[model samples]
Target: MPQSTPSVVTIGELLWDMLPDGKKPGGAPANFVYHAACNGVAATAVTAVGNDDLGRELVSLLSDNGVNVSAEVNDYPTGITSVSLDANGVPEYDVVRGVAWDHIAFTDEVRGLVEQADAICYGSIAAREPQGTRDAIYAMIDAARADAVRFFDINIRSGFVDKEVISRFLDGATILKINDEELPVVARLFGIDMPDESISGQQEVMRELRDRFGLDVIILTAGAAYSIVMGHDETSILPTPKVEVADTVGAGDSFSGAFLAYLLRGYDLATAHRRAVEVSAFVCTCSGAWPAYSDALKEEQA
Candidate 1:
């Protein structure tokens, strides 16, 4: 896998996760792109930032990390969210609405990139917005269907997702990734059997999704438990590596990014699953969603 070949295009929100300590540059798509870059996947992020200082900082961060920022916009002020941590260290966010990301207008350049993409990663959170960005992403999906592998990383944020949006994205996706809690919600919405309220039942739900949608892959994450990877021909489970948590912010996004990176490099489901879990563990050992030392740490783990 040569580093020069562009392997992925992640289209979605690019914002700052403002922790109590300070602001951390994040957004699911950006996090995925970060890990993809570490895995030698030539990745580009198509997102928008505001014309404000925060947006400028985000662009600088991306540039410093070796991520391509040519498609990132600076028309609107950058989006910001204040994150509050609980006693257990779980994060709760207060998202500022109508920010820069809400104005992600599609352009001829974005469409052209999508048409040339090898893989595309997006999520439902970015689609629940002022409608313009959502429309742009949907358009890109339609245009990229023939030549790209669309990965729907269903990062369902509270108050930022709806059934219609979820269904629409699922229909356009070639692969789907969701955390344990979201699997049942999506399965029941799609008229798939909810089955029993167990992890195996969730696996059954995923199997139904794969069979019904003809999806190439389905990834399910269960926090610090084991994660499941299922394809048409095989299934594999990998346990999360035991590590002291700094914060669980971008662990799932890291998993999604690493999984796609390995898959694109022609790794088997089992091996990819292990690598995804390992990278996610590395992320949890750090503070923010897009950790500063991600690439070097990942190389050490490898």
Candidate 2:
């Protein structure tokens, strides 16, 4: 058992995802930290929010969900993404630029938190435009313990991520969590030839990337199909649990959070991968990125 609670810090965007029904609190880092906190870790969200009603609501919601907010208040408006769900419940986002989260300021306090973290998760989207935010993210990653789990969830949002940013982030990542949709894109970007479309071929591609980046793990999640977790010597592949479709807003982020949480708590890789799958399935059945973890939900996971 851990001597104390495991610390997980996520530095990235924290914004409201404007859905068709209403605005839902959603962002990769926010959702990741929220799930990590819910799973009984000391999770902190190191991002920025606008000093506005929307920002206040976001902070309050995160606190209510058990995530510690180490957010900076900035002059710009809070970040918001207009989300449209397809018939299959997959989301297409029209993200707003120049928002508050795009202007995160690196502070000594954030550096301290990163230095002590057991795991840190960041993404490409948050570091896309703002040069300062990208620098801050790099600094925090540098400050983290050498043995820390540096999870880079390459959340390649449209019009945001490119080869340069993705390659730089991968350089520091111990674990790279990406979806099947993104795998091909990355493969093309890096000129890694993918001649076959079989599972073995996919694993080969993943292995090549892992070796190139010195990554310890590579998680390839195929929504509604299967997910593969590849470590240095072992690989665990599990079919995604079938559940009623809601919206896959933060399902992938939840998986990364749960996986890291279990690992930090001393669980074996297979067990951690299993639990992450279960948690991600539960999130897919809920409405927004963050569904209330009521007693029933807790029992289901148990």
Candidate 3:
């Protein structure tokens, strides 16, 4: 018998990444949904796009990749981020503001989707936008089932962040994902000390966040270096598997997606961490986040 797929609903921006070569569909929430689906979970994306070519293509690409879309068509033009990669395939983004996703209005449809989700993924970028978008996200969170896992990927971009906003989101998040740099920034904001010279201090930082936010799990990442996972029972720090370079656009989001999917599917933290690191490394070997997932490539890496 075919097993049921764990359902994950990701809410936030969906847009094109206008890379130097051309454009591809990309956004943190969209990347999370795509990789979650790749991890054998039933994933859906709740975001917005203009009713234009870019929007249509974005939706079609997501659907083709096996992610369900609950996107709203808005009057603003579709969102896009101009991307340029450094020599090491690390990318810098100039995100376009005031797009369709900026105006994602609250609706019964989004609420219903959240209510049905086993895990709901969101990012700081959405709430950093218009008041309406933040309100819409809060409403969806409110409608989620009591036990639904609220995964917050702390994707801070530009000046689109503040301590108050992050704190408010933490009140609802069951899981938190942040990069190495953001960890110290967050620590300082909450009066948690982060000692650079000590690994135990780092763990303390993670534990403080976990306890402070009442989070079930915490994932801290360092690009192409390592990642740390702290939980109620155990904590593990895993080095990123080596891989040939490509533009690292959605690598972090891919990690979050895979970790959540594997965890929901009953994998232990260590096992899930390995898979998450593997998947994220694979993403670094591809040009974009929503790359054409290759079974052969995955097996070869394995």
Candidate 4:
């Protein structure tokens, strides 16, 4: 059954991040679901896992973190990613393919949750790999309520992204979040290579994406340089807050979650943007993605 309050749904992969030291649960959408729940949103994860030990552990971790996840069990093995970190704690992932989440078939449970969701989050990877769940992923995206915020996180991983997949995701997305690295990739895919001034170039790129994709809001994140939120005849450039370093594995996902959670809770866009930046910076100071929300982070939670 759906909850009484509005729900935020993350529709994508749930798998283990096999770190150099040990393993932890960390997929982009899973990280978003975890951080959204931590920041006081009614969060649900709509993805699949294999009927295996790894799958069981992933479910237990989600439940323990206060996320609602009764994922469908697949016959394949659970997804896993091997991670290695740089000196600055930036992580590189060898994300596995042909895992369980790559085949999320349409079901009543996914349909019910999505139909009632206020915001539905999805990544482009769900369409790239294996190509089995591509139809099912599109079906779930179509199932969202008409007023729901269809947030498309262009989480480009490895070489999985393609022009067709990116265009397909943009067809119905209300909001877009892209990092500096991926911005160039998007431009190249769209056949744009214009050179302009620093700020103007960024704004123009954002506007191009907005106009091309019919996005209501465009969030451009430049790690440690600045973050730009463009919408409604205004552009806000917020400098990335400096913080003590931890691995930046899930910082971007946290930003996406916090921004949407604040909006779902009725805060203004500017405030929500600020909160997202702050929360993401805080996450960078912690060890992992789903850090406990302590006195350090100030979210207007229930």
Top-TM-score candidate index: 2
| lDDT of candidate 2 over 1-302, digit per residue (tens) | 78898999999889989998899999999999988887778999998998899999999999888888998998989999999999989999988988888878779899888988989989988897758688888887888899899999998787675777788889989999988888888998999988686778889899999999999999999889999999998999999998998989899999998888888888888988998998898899888989987686577445
Order of candidate numbers by lDDT, starting with the best: 2, 3, 4, 1
**Tens-digit lDDT track of model 4 for 192-277:** 76465376787788888899888999998998888888886877789989888888889999999988887787777888888889
| Rank list by TM-score | 2, 3, 4, 1
Which candidate tops lDDT? 2
Residue-level lDDT for 80 in candidate 4: 94
Off by over 4 Å in 1: 1-6, 71-75, 294-302
The whole-model lDDT of each prediction reads 0.81, 0.89, 0.86, 0.85
What is the alpha-carbon lDDT for the whole of candidate 4? 0.85
List model 1 lDDT by residue over 12-74, tens digit each.
778899988888989889999988887767788888887677788888888788788644555
lDDT of 3 by residue, 161-274 (tens): 688888878888999999987888888888887877255777889898999879999999988778999999999899988889888999999999989988888788998888
Worst 10 residues of 1 by lDDT: 293-302
Poorest 10 consecutive residues by lDDT, candidate 3? 293-302
lDDT for model 1 comes to 0.81
Span of ten consecutive residues with least summed lDDT in model 2: 293-302
Between candidates 1 and 4, the one scoring higher on TM-score is 4
Give the Å error, residue 236, model 4.
Answer: 1.9
